[model samples]
Target: MNLLRERLTTPGDPGALRAEEGERPQSHARAYQSLKMQVHQLLLSRIDLEAMENLSDDHLREELGLMVERLLAEENLVVNASERRNLVRDIQHEMLGLGPLEPLLADASVSDILVNGPQQVYVERRGRLERTDVSFVDDDHLMKIIDKIVSRVGRRVDESCPMADARLPDGSRVNVIIPPLALDGPVMSIRRFAAVPLTMANLIDFHTLTAEMAEVLSALARAEVNLLISGGTGSGKTTLLNILSGYIDHAERIVTIEDAAELQLQQPHVVRLETRPPNIEGRGEITQRALVRNALRMRPDRIILGEVRGAEALDMLQAMNTGHEGSMTTIHANSPRDALSRLENMLAMGGMNLPTKVARHQISSAIGVIIQANRLTDGRRKITSIQEITGMEGDVITLQEIFSFRQTGVAEDGRVQGYFQASGVRPRFQERLRSRGIHVADHLFDPGRRME
Candidate 1:
């Protein structure tokens, strides 16, 4: 008689013979027989926890593997090895990072991954794009994935804190939102960068910029000119800024401030600072403005802001005007003009009673150039405009188009082909260049020819 039947009847298998007679063939009689033998063998092979404590992890794993193999054999089960292996992997992956998305995250070609809840996943691959069939089981499963992501970065996420901004080990930017705040259940956005960060020469090889453009930007960097990179979201502003900042001499002391530090500038003397969000108790927040003000006292030769979004605009502009010549920052805008306007509006966010005209004048004086980037219809990123800040002409800040992208025509492959050409009018900065006894080459500003 089986122990289960005997236990149900009386203690110590009392009615053993009668129980054996009663237990006949049933619908799952074979399953029961198979399960009983495996359990008996498992109990025989069991090691005490105290004994296992002295075993190395590898030894324990090997013993567990042997146990599972013996169990499978005793059951006379012909398991599909690949599917069963995948099943175990999937379970572990779901407990960690939602199985399917993990592969894409590991892929170097993938720059961004968008998972619309659980059903849809899209990836930006190479210069082109495509979608993949990957999903989470449900909202709970998605939340687990988010927790896994943030936990690796030493961040927290819960109802009290339904949002988080963090970075993966590879410096991939991660943002997560959950529940009522998200409205569409849990959401995650990961912006990935190349393992070996792209340099100026790398960008040139990718057709993102010409060698001549790189040279000009390098010269601007060496000249300690304040540059404002303007672009819509994901136009590679920070990437360009990182490459540009590499041109700064390692001797100069550099300070960088960011909401989330993303810039990877390769310089010896660099101080990176990040803004802090309010704590769970709704206190102890260090804002970008505070960082910028504090950066001023650090005796930095140049200040590089990751991006200007709020009251920090006032401090940044003041810094640029007061002996910080090469201070750089980025802003979200469609064009150079809009970026300047956004700066003015963000200055107002400081809650100071400064007039719009005053802010415009400050921007016109502080900023030297605006480098505009745009994501084209064909998914190509190009520097569409480079406008020199020619100071304020009355109430309007004048911007002269130093270099512009004139679309020569579309290629046979449906990609737009264009080259950055200089406007006929020379830059006003030539006078400043002449003052430094550095001649501005006439051919550098020439039109209708490929200089690079």
Candidate 2:
């Protein structure tokens, strides 16, 4: 967990800094610095703060504001009301919230907050990365805020264990890497999440997928066909998984296992499990594989693995082949073929010692659909391919793309303009859907049909 609590801002350009900070230091930045120093000095004075520790933010802010007012008045210093209010808010955040990140966290458009040490901060907005001016006062201040967050999640980050993964109060994913492994300074990456998770309708509106493609996916999911989503990092696999999970019958018990518990499945019978990292002594660690095995004993109608990255692939594949036909998970792969290869490698990591062809056969039989997603250059995520796994043919898993997103052209604004096209190859596994009382129209597989 992140646990550094100091921030220091160093202006890179000395001339610009001198110009920004004129003779009398009249800049708002200067005023904030001066006020911050005053607040720190007063805090160090050991003022009676025992009563304020458990107070609500509003009450605490009111009390802190009054204390600041008294200090400024005694010092015979005068300032603008706006500057004083800003200073008070900053102090409140420093004392009660994440120092410089509070504003970015509150911004709905910001999707990620990357703190590279204390001096440089970056944010992801609209799927594009941009550097932000928001930064901490020094490294200690930044470490303090990091400590505040990771500690809440019962994690620790120090010289002994310099890496930690945690979640925020709002379910945002957090990754912290500190020295001596981090090299430069403590590095913190926070993947921000929306207050309300995205739904299928939202994906359609965002053009992540066409209505026709969404319809096909909903049908397949409701039909209890085992599916795998393949995508690169930040390619919207988790969002797509969350949406498809909605198609499961709410009456059926669903168990979700994740490293950070980011999936927002909206079923009444949902059981969420999160992996546990080992403690300070390097013991009592619970991995995703153990959780997957335990989930089987819980009588789950469907099992959702957030993202299979290791030995857990074997158990998840077994779960799909067994009674849990509708089980779903995501994998880091560029295409359906790569997904299978990745699964094969992961299955080997399970210590099963199965032959290569045997693992390939299991992969062919377990997964029914591979939904490949891509994050385009223009910050749009598209389902580039939807392939179905037919049975193995001569030590190979046969895959046929039933739908593909073909980029017709790029718009003048650099936005990608693509349409989903039917591949004309119908899945050979329609009998699986039929067995579950589901039907698909023949025209859905027409070669000339444009699914958009």
Candidate 3:
């Protein structure tokens, strides 16, 4: 008799039966996977790809479902109606979607997907990493999925070029590294995009920043204050940038540049540009610096760079200095001061022969504010600091903190306990906001007020 049938029919020890019940789901999952693979192979051998190409999507799906049902019956598989339906869906996913990852991608709660290899998959849900039961048959199976992803976006990855960046049709960012570079096997990480992008009100609801801080940010954007958003990876830098960009005038011409197009701007007059990687021949490559120079020629009222990492920093700084008042960008840094330092380093990468004092002055004049976002130890993301650049004092760039989140301690449940507070010192940009008729109340900057 089969193990399941035997356990049900000959129940002797209650403790042993309880132990077996605990393992039933995993055993059933393995059986389902085995059945799915068998039926998938049979369906693939029977279907005519050339004939199916002419069919509409709905028609094709209907035909495939009939074929899958026929194949299961031919193989004498004894599955229930629900199991049969699932088997057909799995086959469809294998042929038409991302195979094993289709379900994870459909889940709105999953923010990130990390595939280490065929046997290991992890996902980030509610800011915490958890392992999932998803797996592929082997390394070759994983490689095929990777190839399908990159090819759809007109990108390639092989031994010669084992690293690639691409985005899904829904705009989720994907990074893949394989083989010699990835010692374990093919590895892929996906940063899922939200269907409905988070707004400033959403950030306040999540306690990422206070309502007062959001008011200041909204005023800065409306007043055309050049701002720099500084944060580390996965700290919601791009999300915050998107919210700030929403405040820009709808009539203004906005141009956005990024390695992969992730920003979801709402303005009608906005133009989005993305960088391109070199072909196998190592030719026909386009960099962000090239796009920035071209954006300036396009007569953009504001330039939004997705991130300033290398030589593009100099171009972006020059654009902001030369009439682009409300331009914005983000940089990966630990703090606001560190962000300025990174900009100085990137300027040197552009092969500029400017002195240290000259470089500092250029940065101080171009960037009016630096908003620092951070992902704390407990997996909570918050805007840690907002500092206004008040021009240069001697050789140093003067920065005054306007708002900050102060961490008191970890709670009993391990959540980061913190409060957002104003820094008392009024920002220099207030006058500029008033000049633009954007009034921010003085009470918003009171140091005594705390948001917990």
Worst 10 residues of 2 by lDDT: 1-10
Candidate 2, 1-452: lDDT as tens digits? 11112222123422111223245456666556756755655554534556666677787767776666655565445678887787777777777788789999999999989999987899999988999988777767788888999899788888888898888998899999998887778899999889998888998988888777787899899998899999999899988998899999989999999998788878899999999888889999999999999999999999999999999999999988888988989999998889999999999899999988999988888899999999998998999999998888888888889889888888999888778888887777677678888787777777786655
User: What does the lDDT read for residue 63 in candidate 1?
Assistant: 54
| Model 1 ranges with Cα > 4 A deviation | 1-81, 84-99, 127-129, 152-154, 408-413, 431-440, 450-452
For model 2, the stretches where C-alpha displacement exceeds 4 angstroms are 1-31, 44-50, 409-412
On residues 2-61, what C-alpha lDDT tens digit does candidate 1 reach at each position? Answer: 111112222233321122435544644343333333333343344355555666755654
Q: State the local distance difference test value for candidate 2.
A: 0.84
TM-score of 2: 0.89
Q: How should the candidates be ordered by lDDT, best one leading?
A: 3, 2, 1
lDDT of 1: 0.75
lDDT of 3 by residue, 124-221 (tens): 99899999989987898899899999898889999999999998988889999999999999999999999999999999999999899999999999
- As for TM-score, the candidate ahead, 1 or 2, is 2
